[model samples]
Target: MPLSRTVRCICIEISKKRFNPKSLEKLEIIPASQSCQHIEIIATMKKTGEKRCLNPESKAVENLLKAVSKERSKRSP
Candidate 1:
């Protein structure tokens, strides 16, 4: 009998580029953990409700994060 292996990371394929901010519904940031050593960024689309994994190291992702932060700050009282 062989031992069953379990998948660690939730993301199967990661997008090297960024998606349109207007089309994005939500963003989930998973920090580096024992299972996955790298930070994971998951985006949910507004229209399709599809989820995509984003490369945390990409410059586009950095800009997206900044934009989200800015928007959030403006919304805060």
Candidate 2:
């Protein structure tokens, strides 16, 4: 099979001062040496076996949920 890449949501936080465009390469090795004090990348995924509660009233969120349900319902029925 051809290689496929899965898209995962990632959130990155870099400190205010060191985020300047020029210093990105220089700051790679050393976190402290760079003007930015801390950088954090978090992948926010629901924990296993946990139910994801959705507010049906939300237009955008509910639309996504409806799309998923519709796809499954189509396959089954």
Candidate 3:
């Protein structure tokens, strides 16, 4: 709706009677993560007090973290 000339106050409502939410929902664009989904991993780590950081490759730190977690579990009281 385009109005030419001057106007006082123009209120356009598109929720209840005018526009559909489904059509508008289809127009939204979002980015997705590649490889493993990071958000889930982050949330899990937050609960368990574990943090994951990016390393140069999956060789050094990845193996290091797994070994540390395994060693930590092996430690006795």
Candidate 4:
């Protein structure tokens, strides 16, 4: 499905930051248009399992979250 305009805007904001694969828990690309794509990242809390969409505008926070996610993966089997 095509991403909403708000999501598209958020994705645009995200693309401007430094790319760090380690910071992202899960990243998926959803087709937005014939010439563009939308990105979705999983933003969740480790202790509570609460989930939310990544905020594209917050580079520092996103990077930190992604790092945490990476650490969790390493701790798992």
Q: Write the per-residue lDDT of candidate 4 for residues 21-70, one digit (tens) a residue.
A: 44444443344564445545544444455444554455645566577799
Q: Per-residue lDDT for 1-77 in model 3, tens only?
A: 88633232122211222222222211211122453222121111223443233222324334445666899989954
- Residue range 1-77, candidate 2, lDDT tens digits: 66323222122322222222222221112222233343322111233332222222334344444766999999995
Give the winner by lDDT: 1
**Model 2, TM vs. native:** 0.26
Q: List runs of model 1 lying over 4 Å from the truth.
A: 1-6, 16-18, 58-60, 68-77
TM-score of each: 0.68, 0.26, 0.25, 0.32
lDDT (C-alpha) at residue 54 in model 1? 82
The alpha-carbon RMSD values of the candidates against the true structure, listed in the order shown, are 3.7, 19.8, 21.1, 8.8
Q: What is the C-alpha lDDT of each candidate?
A: 0.78, 0.32, 0.30, 0.51
Report how far residue 51 has shifted in candidate 4, in Å: 0.7
Answer with 2 or 3, whichever has the higher TM-score: 2
Off by over 4 Å in 4: 1-36, 59-62, 65-77
Candidate whose TM-score is highest: 1
lDDT score for residue 75 of model 1: 100
Summing lDDT over every window of 10 consecutive residues in candidate 1, give the lowest-scoring window.
1-10
Model 1 lDDT at residue 13: 84
